[model samples]
Target: MIPKHTVDRLSNRLTHLKPILSFEIVFIAVFVTLVFFTGGAAAQAPVGGGGGNTSGWETILDNLYNVLYITLQYAGLTILVLGFIVWLSARNNSQRSETGMKLTMGGAAMVVAYFGLGALVSLLEFIAG
Candidate 1:
């Protein structure tokens, strides 16, 4: 069991971190939005050279999927690293430790979801076929 003093300290640290965490989340959201918009625009823009026949919608979807996949991969890695640092630094605080573990698991889940997307697409294709 964690001591009261450790819990108090961890609470104080979390209070200080709350604003920073909010800002990080907002920043990530904005970055992702920008990536999506820009990627969408680029995907829609006409190519100068003629390419083999392909559906424009399919091309756009592929680009969007790639961008999202890469973004999530990086975000998950970043979250996992941050969670590890927090976990290591909050050894004495059960609350902080739990929060860190949750973050780590969430990040891992994101990465897994990213990879699983391909399988999901394949499954859909098979079903459609």
Candidate 2:
């Protein structure tokens, strides 16, 4: 049988985590929706690449991609620097150390994902072709 105190602690942790989880779910849903709509719109639009006439939808997508790529690069760099600082400062506290490690790893993963995104897209295109 589980101890009552342990169960209580677990319940408290779950309550605190609920809002964070909900926010993550909502954020993911919105991102997916935007990407889906943008992709569908782009696909339906006719392609034009002659005599200096470009498709507006494609231009919008290219601008959006550029902005997002730049933003991610900056964000990833900030996370990496902050995570390393936190990790170095929290060496005396186990909980803080653990949190720091998680942040560091998450930041590193984001950076890696940013770098790998083009390769991933290329792989998908190759497979689809």
Candidate 3:
């Protein structure tokens, strides 16, 4: 077993780290928001090209892509925070650990699926064109 002094020291370290953690969180939030807004603006803008005008389907796809991108991006951030919280809690039981793992895996799966679907759609469009 660990000594009480060691535990106390660890607790003190964690307390000291709180401010750094808060700043990291705030920075992440701001960066994600900026990226989302910039990407959204580009997606919303009409694609100016020699393609002789963008088709309705193309416009729809662009909008859908932007929406999906933003949604997935935010969802990912939320999942990460939740997973971190669960991990920080450090449940003694195996069951809780399994639950946290599942949550993280689910979040990862969502990101992969979002990109996969987008790639598939782009491929199909390319082939059709």
Candidate 4:
């Protein structure tokens, strides 16, 4: 049997942690995996050749795509984390209603959109080749 004082302390600590524990865990896990695997290497370039006189529009699109991809990569992780926090809040409180579910779904949608856009870009590149 645990001591009463110890149990009280543990309960208090857990109560305080209830709001953000899920987000923290997800963020830490993603961060650790990325750090261990990638180790700060830059993104790989798309497989293609410049092939004389790339238009201004093409250059602009390429730069925009690169920026969007990088931004989505980081932002997706953050949304995943925020979704977790919202999930925890919903779980702990009955008043939260469907907001947490919406957040989680929205986060998932952004991740999917990021990948979908990447695939679309790749398809366009393939056609151009």
Candidate 5:
């Protein structure tokens, strides 16, 4: 369980961040709702040499996939390493050890989430199909 102070601190932070967070939430929510409600049938892309439908999509997908995979994996690794260092450097401090442990777990979660996203996409495709 999280401590009361941490919960209160996070609540305060979230309160301060409300406007920006609301804007981001609304921005994504509108598009996401449109996506979910708009597509009614499976559409096939045409094959062509000059600016084909799949060309732009393929490039965008490739770039996005590469960026996410590289960034997530490296960021997770960096966090995990930092957490390990923190854990070892503060071996005598129980609070620091706990913080380090949480950070390490969060890093591991991020890595797992990166790997899991592919499977999640497959699952979504199956369900949507």
Candidate 6:
């Protein structure tokens, strides 16, 4: 049962330290989570012309990239298709049409960029070789 005056005084003292205290708390939490969860038990990266297993950093990164591409492909397609439905249902309204157009264009751009980038990388490799 602390006194109200004492509690008020403590609160006032802590007012100026709130930001730093919050930052330190968040930093510690993230550091602990990353170090314990993801940073531990990680394998070595493939480099320096070493003959080794395929479970190195390159494979890990490629898998991550593939995951990213699949997510983007599905998400973009869903948005674009839903936007078309919404826009078509509200065809008399220009606002809805514009929204649908935006979605379609964005999805098209994502699909194009995905394929374009893959092609560009292959082209560069071919040119280099």
Error of 1 at 24 (Å): 13
Candidate 2 Cα deviation (angstroms), residue 121: 4.5
Candidate 5 — which residues are off by over 4 angstroms?
1-52, 121-129
Quality of model 4 by C-alpha lDDT: 0.76
Q: What are the runs in model 4 whose C-alpha is more than 4 Å off?
A: 1-54, 95-97
- Number of the predicted model whose TM-score against the real structure is largest: 1
**If scored against the real structure, what TM-score would every candidate get?**
0.55, 0.52, 0.45, 0.50, 0.49, 0.53
Lowest summed lDDT across 10 adjacent residues in model 4 is found at: 40-49
Q: What is the C-alpha lDDT of each candidate?
A: 0.83, 0.80, 0.77, 0.76, 0.82, 0.78
Per-residue CA lDDT of candidate 3, range 62-86, in tens?
8878898889877976786676667
Write one digit per residue (lDDT tens) for candidate 4, span 1-129.
999999999998898874656887999999999889976443434446545544645776778778889888778767777877877877667555367666777778889888998899789889999
**Model 1: per-residue lDDT, tens digit, 58-96?**
777888888898898899889988888877788689999
Lowest summed lDDT across 10 adjacent residues in model 6 is found at 38-47
Q: Write the per-residue lDDT of candidate 5 for residues 1-129, one digit (tens) a residue.
A: 999999999998888864656777999999999789867433444446455456666776878787898898899988988888887888689999988988889888888987898788789879999
Error of 6 at 40 (Å): 3.1
Candidate order, TM-score descending: 1, 6, 2, 4, 5, 3
lDDT string for model 2 (13-80, tens) is 88887454687799999999999877776556455645545667568877887888777778888888
Check candidate 4 and list the clashing pairs: none
lDDT of 6: 0.78
Model 6 per-residue lDDT tens digits across residues 1-129? 999999999999898774656877999999999888876456544568667656576677778878877877887788778777877887589888898888888877777877876788689779999
Question: C-alpha displacement of 56 in model 6, angstroms?
Answer: 1.6
The TM-score of predicted model 6 comes to 0.53
> How does model 5 fare in lDDT?
0.82
Q: What shift in Å separates residue 19 of candidate 5 from its native position after superposition?
A: 22
